[model samples]
Target: MILLDLFHYWVFIAILMMGFYTVIAKQNLIKKLLGLSLFQSAVFLLFIGIAKVDGGTTPILHPSISTEIFSNPLPQVLILTAIVVGISTSALGLAIVVRIKEAYGSIEEDQIQSKDESA
Candidate 1:
């Protein structure tokens, strides 16, 4: 049962692995940034999944209900912050890539390295 439950996470795992492989194996700076975005998305999915509860409700109190299970709000708050950070990181990375392209005339890592060596 436990192992079967873990199967639900296979897609996220696959996406994470693909992102890592893309970042590592690709020579294009734009592709690497795309992979980084994918990686961040996968992390977001995991955090949201972990924050879910089987029968949880929002953190609220009801006068009629004596027993209530409320989900933790901390993880959600943290994930929101992470999302903002991720956006900022991606924006900065893309700006850098643009500058590199302008300077090197190509976004490929090997090309950039060769240009640097020749200069």
Candidate 2:
């Protein structure tokens, strides 16, 4: 069935929505960051899934394997770079949260906003 073939895509959508919901529904900065990471992971999964090819082999040339499909490696490479960037972004976000906690004494969005309003 088509649904069975696209199962990974469905999983990707589910995780993406969960992460998006967490980011929107959670007030805590840490939780939001975690959700963002989850969202990024889902994107990575989607890309990897797309890069997969049925009955594909590595791109290495082999005369013996004349009839072979090769999966595109570009997406996998780009995802690797994205993963590194995501890690750096997460570290920066965490650092910013720490600074916000230090300055506002709270990481909750509403608390920070109220303090800012009162200031």
Candidate 3:
């Protein structure tokens, strides 16, 4: 059981690292935005996945329902906020990428700056 738990933790960390590295290392503006978005989604997945209590339910409550199957709702609420923020970030990032592409005829940061410097 302990080993299994450790393995799951390692998996999450690995996913996180992969996403982070992509976000940091990508050259294209759109690729970087995609990496950032994936990283955020992985974080939200970790949030929701880890928040599941043992033997928990889907957080719905009804009088007809039953003897205590309540799962945590806080994580769900927080993830909702995260999703909204992610959407806004994606929109902003797309806007920025469009502007950068327009300004330099390319999205690579170095190329864009070089174009600016040359002109």
Best by lDDT: 2
**What TM-score does model 2 achieve against the real structure?**
0.90
What's model 2's lDDT at 6? Answer: 91
**Worst window of 10 by summed lDDT in candidate 2:** 59-68
The prediction achieving the highest TM-score against the true structure is: 2
Which residue runs of candidate 2 sit more than 4 Å off their true CA positions? Answer: 62-67
Clashes in predicted model 3 = 0
**Tens digit of per-residue lDDT, candidate 2, span 1-119:** 99998999999999999999989999999999999999999999999999978888776788987757998798999999999999998999999999999999999999999999999
Q: Kindly indicate the candidate among 2 and 3 with the higher TM-score.
A: 2
State how far residue 98 of model 3 sits from its true place (Å): 0.7
Root-mean-square deviation of every model: 2.0, 1.7, 1.8
**CA-lDDT, candidates in order:** 0.87, 0.94, 0.83
* TM-score against native, each model: 0.87, 0.90, 0.87
* lDDT tens digits by residue: candidate 1, 1-119: 88678764876798899899999999999899999989998888788777777788777688765557778778888999999998999999999999998888999999999999999
Of 1 and 3, the candidate ahead on lDDT is 1
Q: Identify the runs in model 1 with alpha carbons over 4 angstroms from their true place.
A: 62-67
Give candidate 1's error at residue 112 in angstroms.
0.6
Worst 10 residues of 3 by lDDT: 5-14
lDDT of 2: 0.94
